[model samples]
Target: MEYQESFINYLRYEKRTSPHTVVAYKKDLDQFVCFITEMVGEFDVNKVDSKLVRTWIVSLMEKQLSPRSVNRKVSTVKAFFRFLMKEKIVETNPAVNLPLPKVRKKLPGFVEEESLHHLLDDGFFPGDFRGVRDKLIVALLYATGIRLAELMQLKGSSFDTKNYLIKVLGKRQKERIIPYPREMNNLLFEYLEIRNREIGYFPDILLVTEKGKPVYEKLIYRVVKKSLEYVTSFEQKSPHVIRHSYATHLLNKGADLNAVKELLGHSSLAATQIYTHTTFEKLHDIYKQAHPRG
Candidate 1:
C-alpha cells in the first residue's frame, strides 16, 4: 500500500495525469488491494502472482462488471506492477502479458440536427441572465464540441470575438483553438452583457453561477440535461452527447475527417472516425427512402 501512494504521486507529479484520472487509478488500486487482502489474509507485493490477479478478474466478471471496466482495472494492476519493477520492489511483474477482456464498442449517441436547431432557434431559453447563460452553455458545447473540463476553464480572454474563435484547453492540458459559427456572436455578446450587469464583469471566467462563483460540473450537467429534455427524449442528455452531436453533424455535412479531428482536439484520427459510423447510418436511412427502383 505504501507503494500505491508512491505510484499515485508519480502519476500526479511526474506523469502529470489529470486529477480525475489520478482519483480513478487510486480507486482501482484500492479495490485491488482490498481483494488481495481478503483472499490471502494479507497483501504482499512479492506474493502476488498472475493466478491471483486472474482470480480477481474472475471475481469482477462474476459481479457482472462490464468488460470495459474490467479492462481498466486490469490496466491499473498492470501499471502498478510495472512501477514496482522500476522501483526494484519486485522481480517479475505478475501482471505482465495478462489478457484483457474484449470490449464491445458502442456508437456515440447524438441528438438529431433538427431537434437541436428547434431547441436553440425556438427561444426555449428565458431572457434573464441565468437563462441566457444556460442557453450559451448548451450552444457552446454543441457548437465547439469541447469537453466539460475545457468549458469550465474558458474565460473572456479565451475567445477571439472578431474571428469567432475559442481557445480551449483540452485533455492533458493540450490547447487548441476552435471556431464557432458567426451567428453565435450575438448570443455570446448578449450573455456577456447580462453576465457583466448581474455578476459585475468577471472577465476571468466566462460562465458563472447566479451567486457570482464559477460554475462547476454538476451545474453544467444540470443546465445541459434540462435544456436537452425539451428537444430530445433520449435517456442520456449531457454535455458529451452534445459534443457527439457536434462531431456527427459535422461529418454528415461532409466535413473532412482530419479537419474534424483537429476541431474536436482528438490526438488521433481513429477517435474522430467513430462519428463516421453515425454518418453512414444516416446515409443508409436516406438511401432507403430516396432510392426506389421498380
Candidate 2:
C-alpha cells in the first residue's frame, strides 16, 4: 500500500494524469491489491500472478460491471503491473497477458442547432452583466470547444482581441491558443466592461461570481443549465451537452475533421472521428428530404 501510494504520486507528477483520473486508477488497483492481500494474507507485489488477476477479474464480472468498466479496471491493473515491472519489484507482469473487453461505441448526445439558438435567445435581456458574461461563456465554448477545466483557468489577460484568440491552459499543463469568431469576441468585450462592478473581491479569472469570486464548477454548471432551460426543449442539458453540440454542429457545417479535432483540443483524431456520425445523420436527413426518389 505504501508503494501503491508512491505509484499514484508518480502518476500525478510523471504521467500528468488529472487528479480525478489518478484517484480512479488508484481505486481500481487498490481493489485488486485488497483482493490479493486477503487471498494470501500478506501484501507483496512480487507475489501477484496471472491466476489471482484472472480470479479478481471474474469476481468483477460476477458483480455485474459493464464490459467498458471491466476493461478500464483491467487497464489499471496493466498499468500498475507495468510500473512494478519497471522498478524491478515484480518478476513477471501478471496483467501483461490479460485481455480487454470490447464495448460498443455510443455516439455523444448534443443539442440541436435550433435548440442552441433558442437557448441563447432565452438569456436575460439588455446587457445584464452576469447575463452578458454567461452568454459569452456559451459562445466561447461553442466557438472554441474548450473543456470546462481549461476554461476555468482562463485569465482576463489571456484574450487577444486583435487576433480574436484566447490562450487556454489545457490538460497536462499544455497551453493552446484558440481563436473565436467576431461575435464571441465582441460578447467577451461587452462582459469585460462590467467585470469590476461587483462589491466584494474578485479573482483574476475571465469569468467570476457576482461577488467577485472566481467562477467555480457549480456556477458554470448552473449558468449552462439555466440558459439551456429557457432556450431549448431538450431533455438533457449541460455544459458537456453543448460541447457535443459544438463538435457535431461544426462537422455538420463542413468543417474539416482534423480542424475540428484541433479546435476541440483533442489529443487524437480518433476521438474527433465520432462527430462524423452526427454529420452523417444530418446528411442522411437532408438527402431524405430533398431527394425525390419515390
**Which candidate's lDDT is highest?**
1
Model 2 spans > 4 angstroms off: 122-129, 199-203
RMSD of each: 1.7, 2.4
Q: How many pairs of residues collide in model 1?
A: 0
Residue-level lDDT of model 2, residues 1-294, one tens digit each, is 777987898899998887768989999988988888888898688777888888888888899999889989989988887888788887687887776566888888888888777656654544777778788778777777888887788877888888888898777877788888876766776777777654332446778877777788888888888877776667777778888999999888888998888888789999999989878888999999999971
For model 1 the local lDDT of residue 269 reads 89
Name the regions of candidate 1 deviating beyond 4 angstroms: none
List, residue by residue over 214-246, the lDDT tens digit for candidate 1: 999999999999999998999999999999999
Scanning candidate 2 in windows of ten residues, the lowest lDDT window is 196-205
Per-model C-alpha lDDT, please? 0.93, 0.81
